[model samples]
Target: MLLAIDVGNTRIKAAVFEANTLFDAFIFVKEEFAEKIEIILQQHPKITTMVVASVGNLDPSAFSSFEKRTKIEFISHKTKFPFQNLYATPNTLGIDRMVLAAGAVLQFPKQNRLIIDAGTCITYDFVDADDRYLGGAISPGITLRYESLHHFTAKLPLLTKSYPENFIGNSTTESMHSGVVNGVISEIDSFIENYKTRYAKFIIILTGGDADFLAKRLKNTIFANSNFLLESLNQTFQYNQK
Candidate 1:
């Protein structure tokens, strides 16, 4: 069994994989890292390796205690990926994005892929049919947009994400909702449409904390799996072994 961990900007997501099949999954804050990992390892004693892809501040030393039991592999630019990275600043590419791109290339072979990760920041990554990791765009996510409005403006109140009933918001709160939520949807749809114009055929894979919320809202058809990163981490590890 393999334990795949994704340390994102806000929380840690983990999953146990038996071969390529996911057996169990977990989500917790960094504060509970030690306890949660111990519980997970206890529950799944067969796990012998733990693969991590971190885009956060958590130090690897937190996993020191588990070193005796499970081999630890951290994804970095030096790690062998399934695809050729064509990004101008290859080393600067986030490990999470690289894992996602590798997952796209490994899972959906011989096809163009667009992966949209809507987390702290919405990220767009494209891998062509030739398995080249072409760079994509990044934009503010829903919560960031909400916070931006409140932080930048004098009167705007901080708010959570809410779907607007209409594009033309009736009140201030409704308008903020429409702007933050619908605006992101529009931005995503526009990006997808733009990509469609350049590529005749490609698959769109949406993953991240807000993937489920935006999946139905997106005009373009997409394969939305919030756990794609974790699955990709497992796949990337398996690929490295080969």
Candidate 2:
């Protein structure tokens, strides 16, 4: 079995995969990194190889517990990927985004792909049909929007994410929900429409903590899987072995 870990800005997700089939998956916060990973290690002794893709400030030492038992690797710009990265600022590209692009290529071949990750930040990454990764955009995510509203302005209390009761919010909390949730839905739909105008037969992949929340609201067809980055990490590791 192979262990794949994706440490994002907000959460750390780990999964055990036997070939392409996922055996088990776990998600936790960074503070629980050592404890959670240790438990996962104890539970899945068959995971001989571990690969991590991180876009957070997690210390590398957190994985030392696994190092003694498995061959571990971290994904960086230096890591080998199947897709050709054409981003102007290659060093600035997030390893998580790069892995997602690689996963799209491996999972869905011969097509243009747009990957939207909705977590701390909503990131849009595009990989063309020819397997060249052209950079995409990033925007404030669901939580960020709520936090921004509360932080930047006075009297707007920080609110947990919830779908707007109606498009036309009647109260203060309702308005904030509409602006944050409905606004993001509109923004995503606009991006999909624009991408469609330029590319034909393109596939949109939505992943991250807020994927399920946005999936129901999005009008465009998308393959939504929250574990995409972890899956891609395993795919990248397997490809490197070959």
Candidate 3:
């Protein structure tokens, strides 16, 4: 069994994979990192390897105690990837994005792939048909948009994400909801449309905390899996063994 860990911006997502099939999954904040992971490991004694890809501030040393029992591997720029990265600033690429691109290349061979991760910040990473990693874009997610509105203004109240009853928002809270949710949906659709114009044939993969929420709203066809990063961590580790 393999323990795949994704240390995202706000939370840690961990999963147990029996080969390519996911057995179980978890999500917790950094405060619960040590206790949660310890309990998970104790419960699944078969997990012999823990592979982590961190885009957050959590220290890798948090896994130090488990090193004696399970091999701990951190995915970094030094880790071998399946695709040739074409980003101008190659070293600056996030490990999370790199793993996503690697997952796309390994899972969907010989096809152009665009991965959209919708969490604290929405990120788009594209890998071409020839297995070249071309960098994409990043924008604020729904939560960030809502927080920004509340933070920047005095009267506008902070709100959670909610689909607007109609595009035309009549009230304050309703308008805020419409702007954050619908605006993100529009931005995502626009990005997909723009990509469609450039690439005649390519696959779109959406993953992250808000993936499910936005997936149904997207106009383009997409493979939506919130657990893609964890799965990719497992694949990346398996690839490293070969």
| Native-to-model Cα distance after best TM-score fit, residue 152 in candidate 2, in Å | 1.3
In candidate 1, what are the lDDT values of residues 104-190, reduced to their tens digit? 999999999999999989999999999999999999988989999999999999998888988999999999999899989999999
lDDT of 1 at 182: 90
On TM-score, the leading prediction is 3
* lDDT pick, better of 1 and 3: 1
Query: Residue 120 CA error for candidate 3 (Å)?
Result: 0.7
| Candidate 3 lDDT, 145-195, residue by residue in tens | 999999999888988888898888999988888888999999999999999
For each candidate, give its TM-score against the true structure. Answer: 0.97, 0.98, 0.98
lDDT of each: 0.95, 0.92, 0.94
How well is each residue in 90-186 modelled by candidate 2, as lDDT tens digits?
A: 9999888899999999999989999999999999999998999999999999999999999999799999999999999999999999999999999
Q: How many pairs of residues collide in model 1?
A: 0
Off by over 4 Å in 3: none
Total colliding residue pairs, candidate 3? 0
Q: Which candidate is the best by lDDT?
A: 1
